[model samples]
Target: MTHKQKPVIGITSGDLNGIGLELIVKTFADARLLDICTPVIFANNKAVNFYRKTISESNFSFFHTREFEKINPKQVTIFNCWEEEVNITPGTLNETGGRYAVTSLEMAINALKEKKIDGLVTAPIHKTNVQSEQFSYTGHTPYLKASFNAKDVVMMMCAENMRVALVTEHVPISEVAKQITAEAILSKLAIIHSSLQQDFGISKPRIAVLGLNPHAGDEGLVGNEEQTIIAPAVKQARNRNILAFGPYSADAFFARGQYEKFDAVLAMYHDQGLIPFKSLAQGEGVNYTAGLEIVRTSPDHGVAFDIAGKGRADGGSFLQAVYTCADIIGQRAEYGEQRANPLRKVSPEVVSRLEDEKIEE
Candidate 1:
């Protein structure tokens, strides 16, 4: 956790047919990135070489390892999880690509739980194809929540300026309204508040909660969720000493630059938050699974299957994910230290008593 001793960051090569490996290789190609953290990729050497050659990125290479202890700090390492021959068909969706993506993710998660890696930065995975008996979740947030046995977790998408957390994820738009309740809104608010403090190191995070309906239900003209569900939840959160406010109309909140006034924003659903975040982030956003004991992050974008093998996929988001993971690890370490030995604030009466005692002495 020191400046000289870098944290080991584990990267999961997403679907083989996707741009996972390409981003991994391109991100690590910069030698200066090694100064912050040691990267250990969960992928086979064959797959790595395949992508390297396909992208004409010969300068990129990784140290092959079968054991965690064998990872090299000065160079990037690729831990081989599978050796079976599989066709590396880019821009195609198949079960084989999904299976290997799961394999790489499983291995990386094991390493993370074993303390071999400090944090995890995952690549994009084809959610539908990656579905299997072992993995039955909708996305990474839920999977990680179950993996760590965390009771509640928030899917927070972050950039330099804007940070947005979702109340409902991976659910259909029709089911979204049904899922929006006072309890659900309150739970997400609590998680978002706690995560902003612990994970991002915010002392008193100001969170803006977006309404479920348009114009925040037009004051209950369009929908009653704002009054019966979201507004009540905001009131309850405020009563509980959480710095939460507003069942703000989503459109005006962003349009008026009101998001910048708060530490974080909680959206009611997926597109409500992601659309604005992606548009404003300019391809530098990171999807962070907050409220978990361990740190996990991924690029905000999904697997670019259309442009998978053309060597045209942008690595900016993936690189930002890596840097964001490292930064959160450091921030959490510092937060822990501060929590262990917090500075005491002396009241005026206590200070007067101390002064009197000093005078008597």
Candidate 2:
């Protein structure tokens, strides 16, 4: 495929019984999406058809094929990963849901590795059900980290107003403090820094670090994590020429609308970042996995078990996930091109003269 061709995005049907397919169907129903990126859903035709019935308004249709060469840019494609007839119980958690979710993900990742898909956009999955011998990780971030052998990956929740990256993801509240080290902070910072530049096209991104305690530890009265751990990490980041600041109180930070001032914010843990991000996102939040070899994005929300087959699942976040995935792919390509043939640094005198020179129309 040429660089000018539309990117092929692999979509994983999360838990079959959940809102995963619902979101996918609703988002792709708008045929205009096919114009930007061709979607290759890694799922069984039966399963997709099952969910398609739930969403009455969905006009989503697809070509059924197992071959990547058969993929059509103008049509949605269902890359059949399995042909077995399985029971799909919407809003119910079962082993079948977990098994098929894993199957869909495995096939999609394989396609991604084989370069059949340009990027990946995953729907939500049940954490407990999707665990076994092959998939033992707590969530997608860790699973993907191990899948690609990445040293580390940052779970960044993105929206229009602000972007938030978590320092510790899916860890217990008790173990959260134990995991907050300077090295971990710096590692996440590096990923977020590079991601901002390459994925989001931010030239000089400003990052804000949130405290691990209330009122930023109140100068050691509430806790010393801000002083000893988070603050020092911020300082170390600054020394590395990263524009990182603060061990600011998380509550005051969002309450005061301080996040709008920076390009991204690095929160200490999952809830610290997500709670505020989801609140501000207005259903358009995208969960992006940074520091990975391949582009992957997902809706910030999880599987809605209660409203799975109700046709009430909002596709805003899922649509944004697709949009963000395609955007980052383009951004990475442009960033790569710029890096390959970067402009030479000019002298200050020459720059001044060029700025002062008048151009003829």
Candidate 3:
């Protein structure tokens, strides 16, 4: 039997005009990354060269190949998804950018599905530009959920100190409340718990649930969603043996640094979780999609159109994303191996007989 010591990670060149390629080039400039995983960039040679030239200071280069078998483990490989030269106008928003971004993502996803790649690290895409008749989703999370036919998925933000999972992502504030049901919270909690244990190697995960209303509804005075909706969901989760607590006031929880006490925090909405996470992440946060059959991670930030081609884009989050993807791949393998064969429990009678036999011997 043989196993690959290094995982193959597929990187998508996000928008042609965005900082995605810059981040990719900057992150891989160290060359040490190839030691952990074989890097495959799903983009044309033109795009790769464009970014490489734009960031002239970077000495990073890639092995261009259209064939998967020719992928080099010791160097970066550019898997040409398209040969047509694209007009890459950095820091610009247009339909062309969106369309090309989708193309790159689709190619990477196909490779992931075929097991050609062990994990995926997607670059950020503009939610508006990427939308078309074929791709109508808001962002990567829902798109991935539908792509893999995943029953559910949570957009979990991971940083050095804390992990935060959103209950409702990319939804308007008014619609957020309507979507916050007991079932929704429980579903997210279950996914978060499983992800913590499986993807993160937490044996027993503790999840802190954030409240929807101010002061957690102030004990039903401010709002009752906390009492009627959230509290019940926590109880149901506990009944199912999940260590889920709170419906805690969001402001207080993060302000008091209570998130440090738990394995992960589940917020009622996007801003509730992300605002604090981005502030705390300090430019090194990775957005991981949990409950997927495959590993997918991206930089916590979006396509910084302002800093796209200026070579000022920070690669910290993207670098962390790569690390996180490889780590989860390894963790899942270890977790699977741990559960592959369980020790059979000995009966009390067998134990007593064994003890007696041992004494006689």
Q: Where does candidate 1 have its weakest 10-residue lDDT segment?
A: 337-346
- Clash count list over all predictions: 0, 0, 0
Residue 347 in candidate 1, Cα distance off native in Å: 18
lDDT of 3 at 33: 94
What are the runs in model 1 whose C-alpha is more than 4 Å off?
1-4, 344-361
Quickly count the clashes in candidate 3: 0
Q: For residue 305, what is the lDDT in candidate 2?
A: 94
Q: 1-361 in candidate 1: lDDT tens per residue?
A: 6423688999999999999999998889898899999999998999988888877644786789798888889999999999887798998999989999999999988998899899999999998998988999887888999999998889999999989999999999989999888888888889888888878888899999999989999988999999888888999999988999998999999989899999999999999999999998999999999888888999999889999988888999999999999998988887777777463345778878988999999
Q: TM-scores for all candidates?
A: 0.94, 0.94, 0.94
lDDT score of model 2?
0.92
lDDT (0 to 1) per candidate: 0.90, 0.92, 0.92
* Per-prediction CA RMSD (Å): 3.2, 4.0, 3.6
Count backbone overlaps in model 2.
0
**Of models 1 and 3, which has the larger lDDT?**
3
Ten residues in sequence with the least summed lDDT for candidate 2:
352-361
